[model samples]
Target chain A: MTTTRIHSTRTPAFVEFQASPGHRRPVAAPSNVDVAVIGHSGQVGSALLARLDRTTEAPELPGLQLREGINRSRHLLVGDGSVNQQDRNPGTLSGLGARLLAGGRPAVIVDCTADATLPRHYPEWLRAGIGVVTPNKHGFSGDPELYRSIMQAARKGRAPLNYSATVGAGLPVIDTLKRLRRAGVKPAAITAAVSGTLSHVFTRLSAGQPLSEAVADARHRGFTEPDPLEDLSGRDVARKLVIMLREAGLSQVRVELEPVVPDAWAAALPGQVDTIEALREKDAGWREKIVEAQRDERVWTYLARFDGRTARVGPVEVSRDSAFAGLAGSGNRISIESAEGEAIDIHGPGAGVDVTATAVLADLVDAAFLLTRKG
Target chain B: MTTTRIHSTRTPAFVEFQASPGHRRPVAAPSNVDVAVIGHSGQVGSALLARLDRTTEAPELPGLQLREGINRSRHLLVGDGSVNQQDRNPGTLSGLGARLLAGGRPAVIVDCTADATLPRHYPEWLRAGIGVVTPNKHGFSGDPELYRSIMQAARKGRAPLNYSATVGAGLPVIDTLKRLRRAGVKPAAITAAVSGTLSHVFTRLSAGQPLSEAVADARHRGFTEPDPLEDLSGRDVARKLVIMLREAGLSQVRVELEPVVPDAWAAALPGQVDTIEALREKDAGWREKIVEAQRDERVWTYLARFDGRTARVGPVEVSRDSAFAGLAGSGNRISIESAEGEAIDIHGPGAGVDVTATAVLADLVDAAFLLTRKG
Candidate 1:
């Protein structure tokens, strides 16, 4: 194991650990806070590390010390700016969280990986009084049992666990839902265009582009996953829908995914080239559907809809003048209606490294505030 | 003088004073918390009181006790469900803040009044360690010096002062702006239609209704103020813009209001009949503009724009295919663009007694959370 030491030149300013404007003050200004970044070498993780690197100068987050940065092959320490090769990989990062808290200071772990196995460690870290902040959806959306345990652990140890970036990137979807629930206003329905990758592809298709070409365009624009099949399968949007339903106070959530791409084609795909060829094979079907929508003054969009009981995601036709039709490239829109028929609509970019990094940093600050108050 | 005692059938459950989903826990479950309502006789105030009345059974806010209910003519206590007329009035309610904290319990004041005079007492109450939550924009949008003092007092006494309802009712405009600032992202520009009354009237005009009929219809639908001039003058939206600008970290804000109704007509309006007649006289001018917009395939809307330095509110033309033109009757919309050009658009109803009351209740919960942590 490689050990790391982070020395923040500026004094730790816990006096500024506030949620609102100058309102919250901890009992004492804490001296040190250790932040361990798991998977900090990825795109968003590296952006977050860069932001944290500037915290000594940035007033938004005053004194967050980046204790360690762990990736696939190495765990780099910040002090002395040292880098070392790790004998073990991140799959065995079970005890790293426990070691972070050995100094008897407040510790927070930022999980920036999309690894499925990493979420299993969240409950342990949270129950041990270590804060957990993540933009990863696997933890909450993969297994419903895991979601319950994570929430339970946060309550048991009184540690803040924030994953606002899991669903809508930088959008306030989760926080808004929590606020509505806190005020005794339950949502009756949720209609959303959540996946920026699919949104971009379908928008191009609506503009008379070929399906294969649109997929390649989105891939070149960095909107799709390395494997374009991941974006075409509709599973990504389905996971987001599950997370949203649970946040909307639904105890038992079952989302039915009707993928725009046929499930069989996505399942048996071999490689990226084949994925493009497969998309080309389905061009005629999609073109016919698009022409039908055009004839009826409608546009096709991939949408996730939840009406109190049922949650479904698939390609749906909306009026040409509707908000969904007006969504441009890489945009996300959600219309949430309350039990009383009141509605609020939010629209913004759903995918970006900078905005997503900002969301993670915001969560880190909130976690730090929680730890400060604990002291 | 009359003294009121409030009893909660449920135990004071301070453990549930959480901002997230069961993530925050106070050190101790406080025994009692007193909530004093000032100006509880008005429309929103009465709705908030009714919601507080249901708190005994609602799990959202568990055990907040209503200690005092003060209107212009009387202050009634809740003990034994008694109501009595008082000799003294509310204008002299200077020392009530100190008295609420006399019992050694946590105290919070919910200001539901639009009264300009009551805000003068906010700093005293906040500095006394009593939380202040209000839907009243008068406190923050009035004298700039008072805004500074209220914020300073909140810091000095470490008490929460929340005014989220001041800007977009329950639409999360202020909170979103604060979040953007906290993430080190300052908005470059803001374009908003924040007044529901004005939005309704303009939408009606765009649909070819006469200006006088539109104003009268809005007033009859309870969308306008008691005096139509207040909404017609564009002052209401200007106040909201000021609050938004201040929250956006602008130190000095000056708003130039170009009313849809002519300044002279709104300024010297004698009564509602004259107000309607004055609107009638301006019908041809508005009709000409509307016809020109129709010819150009555009729609007119009252908009508030802030471009970092200058703040202006006036009538503007938007393309018929744009979101501003798509905004229906009584809907509010705000688009905030960050310095980096990232944008988030929020649309919803900006006015309603129930939603505004809900916003106040949400703030009350937040204040309760803050006070609970202090104990």
Candidate 2:
């Protein structure tokens, strides 16, 4: 700090402070990286398309309204002529060309599909060293073996798989978990209202709405999945719970979901939750239960929770003071307890085209920055 | 969509899916970049060192416990043999070396000092293409002209200046605002509790505590700056507001801050709050005011707010139902109004070393990733 003084006529550049090699060349321009957006027909998918196309209709896509100014992908292949939301076979999913699957240079794929079969191709993409940015939860919250496979793929590909939008849309659940893990704080417990649709139902039902009405409203407003019953079955919450647990370092915990409903109705429902018919409650026990909980000043929400030794997903009765109480429509809330016993709560809008698209856009930006590392 | 079915071998490598120029070699392992820690003796700087060294004794740091597993940067320079916390001369600041400034290749300078003079060196470093990551507020919120110089330097250097930890520690306020800006959502308004020390004081004061006791406690725990008056003064909050407004694209807005003096002390205190003697209210009117506010079920906290047309800072009374009613200790909160009327509230720990260091580490990671661009 005291020996390297060189007098200059003009204001000396700060570069004079560091050990700059005066003979080196400046960095070249950004690489010729291409971007391929798969699943371009869905809600978030369409919004991304609107953003890329410089249109104004993606109003529902949270941050899409502001991204038109700085979009840098020069070669944008939307669906590569005919890709759809359901194209999941290894051959079809892998056929988006090297820019999406395998590239000698850095490239990216904005995957928006919810197809369960697509996760089967994650390892291949990873192995090929292609970056993937997606809101699709299938690849992350699926089989525990697959989760490991995805991670291994990332290492093998020497590529980043940014799926921050998978767990809680734009709520930053994944990033926060990663930071907590990075900080050496093992999360002792993570309790979350993970299903935005279910949360919408609970928050509304407490304010004097029928269970069916709340579910229908959430579905009509596009808060629920394609199917309304998916919010009621507790499977979605269970998937999110497993992902949270895995992020917290409990990679082997497999949680077999117990439906939020009672045993009588659970038996009558189908293995799937794509329809209200699967929730066969003749006396409307679900509605009555919600109203009953409200009367006791207890808010009932579909909670996905893990406490180190156990992971469970079900409707839990929380006091009015609970972080989950009075959660607004389509909002997600997560409260994590560190090993040190201090708790941190992070809550935000968990779904909707805008929130999910903005999260996916964030991943896309990460992929863009990482692409310079041409593996 | 029927896809191209060209599968002759076992799970055709997704790598086979890309247009490979068989001539190119695999990416060389992440570049030979070096990292320099400028303020190694400080709390956050030491915590970062502990993380890089894989040690376990950074109890004051928020996230060092989790980062030990993945700390990379092989050529680490703790300090340039003579840099101290308060050395502010341009000659001293610029002596760190090329790797910390204009490197032959990509490199990073992790700035942790709060020295006002250090920011003057930023434009020169940025102009040289050296990456900058920090929690320091001086560079971003000092003079409007300097802010412009820094941005222009980033473009000139083709380097990134990441200061996400500046305004909200690890709460992601800067990132969120930038995202909103990118999405073309001109943020209409932003209201925040930017002072964790003041927030903590208000929260505790509402629960029955003397002003002096609160100040002494915060001082003892290192919540306030070395000078307790720094927390009482509105300077920190005002700086944060300017940064937030600039992020929202209001670069020209000049805010005249009115300090958070309670009604009883508004007319009694000196122009500056750099000493406890300045808070000489013989009857303890300040304490009684907090008590009176509590009686009305209203909580009071220092607030820094901007609503596009105006920016202000002061102690404001918020009802029990308001989000600001009970801020957690040393935590920050920001509520943003999008171009639309929707309000988004983001709150988290704002002042702890761990929180801020983790945030700086995130920017460090970003700088590392951006280095692959090779300016």
Candidate 3:
């Protein structure tokens, strides 16, 4: 037992644990949950698999069966480590529901893929009563029609489709929004720093590091995507803003994305080496902007805002005393300003494999609980 | 329709609210929830009753049947406004479970009382398979034995026991702690400004107001207890700290509170007028401390901290740039620093009747959903 010790403020007192189950995870007869991983080899997916497969004295989630792993080319049986003959079926979410239902238990598809095409299958899978849990942003933040369809399908089938990891990694961003919407408290405006990579880059720039070094550092520390252009182009932040806006009742708001790097600059630096060299060459321009911001006692921040309908995301100069200026490292900060003039701020690390995977597992557990009770 | 209009950032677009249900509340056949409000005439309870009874065009919580209202003197049937013959039963939580069970639907008890003895009924009520939702702090932050029994009974009966409003009103404090614990992330330290009344008082003090004036102002604004001594004595903050520390897995940690006002001064004031006058007479002492804080460029904040096991709460001098110093009005701010040194901060109002009622309703809805599904 790894117990945290502290200096006693009073006499040594031991409070007995009543041999009770911890909160949330009820100590009921074990309900088997058959789970399929769509992006099985990805960072979050693999971490989730490892957590599910590892057995411990005190099990957090018991009876979770890793039925199959479905990647692009193959479908592998998790128990036997053998490649299944049935590959990705073009229809019916690659037969994910069928495979999981074969286990005679609650079925769930864990999508960790960041690709756009996977989300198209979410509605069909959810409508089939197979729960969907993911850190995937493409489904909720992409096409409005798809987002609407996914929500409708989940409701129609009475299945749990949780995408809390889509916004601020493991932070309770989406859950907060859903609660507010449920109570009919619509947000008048939402100001957010949703991209951890961009947050890091801006924090470094504020600390006098050049843009090229900041981008390099972020990528080296695994904060940015494999292609850093995805983060640098501000699409990631835009996507998160879209998700929040949709969650806040503006389902089809236009997000005018103002990228940190210009389209011409992004187009100019296609290759990795060329991108680094080009960014290094453009250091002088960034230096001027940084100096200007410092002179005004302001910090440069990539901000995303949605006020009722107009949604825009880009870099902006904010006061030194502002909350946005206080953010550091790979942290994400979202401030929801409700129509009633109440504001709630949530801050945490917005990107990481462990945290994101844990979020997916939390959602999976909720779905499994619902499945068990409904069954 | 009270629609908020915004200038079109693009072409005017109407994203149809598809013929689908909202995110959380399923559009299936209505699940009737028979609710009995226990302190139904109290501030939070009355607000909750109003919200539950109001028939808006767009019903936020549908199929909710307000069965009975249990106040100090009477048990009134909410539907027809008739008093029931059965008063306080002195046993079985005043027969709350029996009355709601008679409805032949999902039964729930919403405890909005602050008395200490109401918590003793929690274990028995939960063990009987009736769900509980409360904003009451007494049941959670009081005796360790009762806390253990309540949790054990909840798990044993598979009942949903939610107290999210206990610590931070409606700021998602307990929910965040539960999520982190579920993911196996143990918080190393929890630093919080959990008292909205004290937060307002200190904010005023920092802005050059005397302690006496600040307390009076807070009371005038309906932020403090009817008896200001409860807020001034610091016991409320201590109870909140205890609840938070237990939620962070230190279920039996002792909280040593340093009151904002000394015992000598507190005992000297017997009435409301005497309290205000005594506080005014002690203005010189508070002014000295305020001036000293200003000289050091610090802000006076009532902060609660739980470092592993040693829980302590009181007033502290924090730098102006710190998060605690930034809390304004009646907001609560809680920062959970994980063992790995990652910190997540949640900030919002810590005291309000409407928000607290909403928090209780959210929990009630969740409990009702679970019951509906289980049935």
Candidate 4:
């Protein structure tokens, strides 16, 4: 008999057989579905474009046939989510978001842009029967009213807006919380090191490098936001925590504390990486901060914690045995204390164009299923 | 004007929110659908029964109003799965499995049993257009031919079979691999501490507990199989690894080696745990084995590994930094080294009637989606 198994060398008994059990028929691309993507040129956006533009690709689940490139009769836009003069849509996704809210046929919109103004339009899109999936965190975490509005829209639309990538990139944080809630498990607490940008910076800092050096490395490696200040300011991590809290049915969550760094240093920061040097130069106490940090073996991690009654996002010192201690560059780890009081940890690479894009694609599949279920 | 946010009590700036963004219309349960559950009397089965019977609860997902109890015509038999005198149509899951193939109305068959013979009928059930959601590992990790048969039936019937609970209870190991593969990240290797029983045994063993004492503790906690021999045998872990490998597109797996424990000791063991003392007494070298293990800090973990070309399941000494080393009792951890050279770790409770049952219910929601998609 022929030996078809790759690891057949390990076990001689594993011989090739013509037909094995448990086969699944792969789902093909959906036909004539009008889908539009709002962000195209950004990192995650470009990755999604590449995935969709690939000609010879494996079939995807939830069965989507992505017609990449911009054509707003249903388009996959990949820019800053702002509509151009060549299109019928405009603004922070409000154009298509409204289009979805004012729906006719079953269409879809996958958001890859990270603009705060765009998420305001999500409820309308969902309400109009448009399936929405995104990695953009601002949509869910920006304002509590906006968060409720989005959910209310979804409830009215009878659609699902998937934001699994919003919390831990490719990690299934939000989905886990949702499933746990649906299964009657109350999520008691959440301790997550979710910002890959901060994790990368801290990983380098933990390795005896100075804060500036770590920041420089993270910026160079494309892990930090173009503004670097946004990551260091802790706003990114705070937004992510807000989104997660809302999903756990602990809503109306607001960032309880400002960034741990001094306000003067953060306020002096410019809007982009062009001013990183100035931002660092203005921070006189960074070295002193390091000395205080090095006085102990505890590693510094920008953490988001919600203990049912309180939700806060700030820097915290985690010990060697802490799940957050071993977090490497751009990796996220979440230790969830479920209602059963079971503490579980899920870890993985939390950011990257490919990883984030993979999360977006998966959400597309989820949105498709949600659509089917709605029907 | 009202500060309704929970964390508002902690931070003064936090206030109540009127709305939020990114809404998802929660799906209600399906109406008037036929769902037949086999192995209804077992732990997971009973849990499923309780869930179905609790209809006055939250408008459950996809609007499925489960009519729980034993009705033989299309029964949710929560028992040993043996077609008793009460069965209307016996064998191959009664008329339920066959009805799915016949293709009339919407139907579902949730298998909660753990019998090798019972799973052999999954293919026929799936082929009959019946949705199958199961936590039973046997159906997937059993005979290679049977595995292929079930999959072929699913493929031919164009129905999705969900088995996420088969590997890591409520953890998303199978779903993670599926998404990764679909995104073109070939999963390269798997290193997992997959057995809760073994995890318990090892956790105790590492704490200087005698092998016999550890086995007794595990049995008392209900972590071990009723016949602790089945757990100690490593066969369970082997089967789980097979299912994982196949999900990563590596099929034709086989368990070529038996448990490391002496055949004389294991073979002489009784079916139930009434003779656990005899097992400890028969083991003439277990204490010495513990001393050897304690000489160094290396912890013994029942690890299952597949390194692209080789697959092995047995006891191995893991260093402190090893992912498996951190696993505690009833916990499961899987480290996947994907083709992208990323080692991702997923850890959580591996087993429990409640946890496994929760996973089954989630899959039921998924199966409902799959059914809608198929239509």
Order candidates by lDDT, high to low.
1, 3, 4, 2
Q: What is the interface RMSD of each candidate, in Å?
A: 18.2, 19.5, 8.0, 9.2
RMSD for all candidates, in order, please. Answer: 10.9, 12.7, 5.6, 7.0
Chain B vs. true chain B: TM-score for each candidate?
0.88, 0.77, 0.87, 0.82
Model 4, span B2-94: residue lDDT tens:
111122121123222222433233444344345677777677888976776333233434444342333325443332344443534554355
TM-score of chain A, all candidates: 0.88, 0.76, 0.87, 0.80
Candidate 4: deviation at residue B174, Å? 1.7
lDDT of each: 0.74, 0.61, 0.74, 0.65
True contacts kept of each: 0.16, 0.04, 0.16, 0.19
User: Which residue pairs clash within candidate 1?
Assistant: none
Give RMSD (Å) of candidate 1 vs. truth.
10.9
> What pairs collide in candidate 3?
none
Interface RMSD, candidate 4?
Answer: 9.2
lDDT per residue, candidate 2, B105-193, as tens digits? 56677788787877887888778777778888887777666776776677557677888888978776786776554444556777888
Candidate 1 chain A weakest lDDT stretch, 10 residues: A1-10
lDDT of 3 by residue, B1-375 (tens): 112122222212222222112344445655677888889888988998877743222232346677877778766675555555456545535667776667677778889899789889888878877889898888777776777789878766667888988988778788777666555566788888888889889889888889989999998988888788889777787778777766665654677777777756577666546677678876777778778877877777887877766767777777776768756677888888777778788887777887788778767776876776565
Least well predicted 10-residue stretch by lDDT in candidate 2 chain A: A14-23
lDDT of 4 by residue, A29-70 (tens): 433334577666567777886775331234334445443333
Residue-level error in angstroms, candidate 4, position A81: 26
